[model samples]
Target: MASADSLSKLLRCPETRQELRPLDDSKLDELNEAIRAGELHNHAGDEVEQTLDAGLIREDDAVVYPIRDGVPNLLIDDRIPLKDSD
Candidate 1:
């Protein structure tokens, strides 16, 4: 995975065209846990069934683009939208 500093400098959200920041460790861990528990979802309201190794959350916290194998999957369809936890 790219270092947080590097990601912050280089990555942007594919959907909103806004800058992205690497999720902090605690937040990353929480998201990963949710992924493992089958709790993650996308904007389309579909469940995210894959593991997120790491991610860059949008500055507005609206969505997260997953990073797999050190590559940020910034495709719009790949974005995981942030949702209120029930």
Candidate 2:
């Protein structure tokens, strides 16, 4: 997992170009649960099948970038689009 300070300095939303913050624990857990259930999807409609070890949420909360093995996967096509209810 990437440290909050490092991630804040290095990550941004690929689509929105918004700054990213480390996802809070509760939100991370919720997202992980959704991923585990195969319920998470990206903006391009691709299913997210991998468990999220860490994540960064866009400043506007519109998307989440998964951090795997301490690296932020900021690819536009891999970003998880956040719904109003998520």
Candidate 3:
């Protein structure tokens, strides 16, 4: 299980290019499962209602993050295009 602090270091905004804080521990776990399961682009828990980082909450011994505004955008869009080594 990855720590929220490590996950926080892993996360970054797509458009803003800013570091993202773990929504919560529970949300972090949910995010881990979701990412491994291909649920969303990346693990970005409910940011609509809950704080960017909230208290830990457990469910079924699993973390469940609230879906905010029906979307989770955690991917960083690299502006620099890949250069072909032709």
* Maximum-TM-score candidate: 2
- lDDT per residue for candidate 3 within 1-86, as digits (tens), equals 99756865764444444554434466556555544565433123322323222322222222222334544433332111112210
TM-score of 1: 0.76
Candidate 2 residue-wise lDDT, 1-86, digit = tens: 99668858776666667789888889889998998998988767888888889888889887888889988888878888786643
Error of 3 at 68 (Å): 23
Best by lDDT: 2
TM-score, one value per model: 0.76, 0.82, 0.27
Q: What does the lDDT read for residue 76 in candidate 3? A: 30
Candidate 2 stretches greater than 4 Å from native: 1-7, 84-86
Cα lDDT of candidate 2 equals 0.82
| Global lDDT scores for all candidate models | 0.78, 0.82, 0.37
Q: Candidate 1's residue-wise lDDT over 1-86, tens digit each?
A: 89768747877776567889887778878878888898887766778877777888888887888888988888787688775631
lDDT of 2 at 23: 83
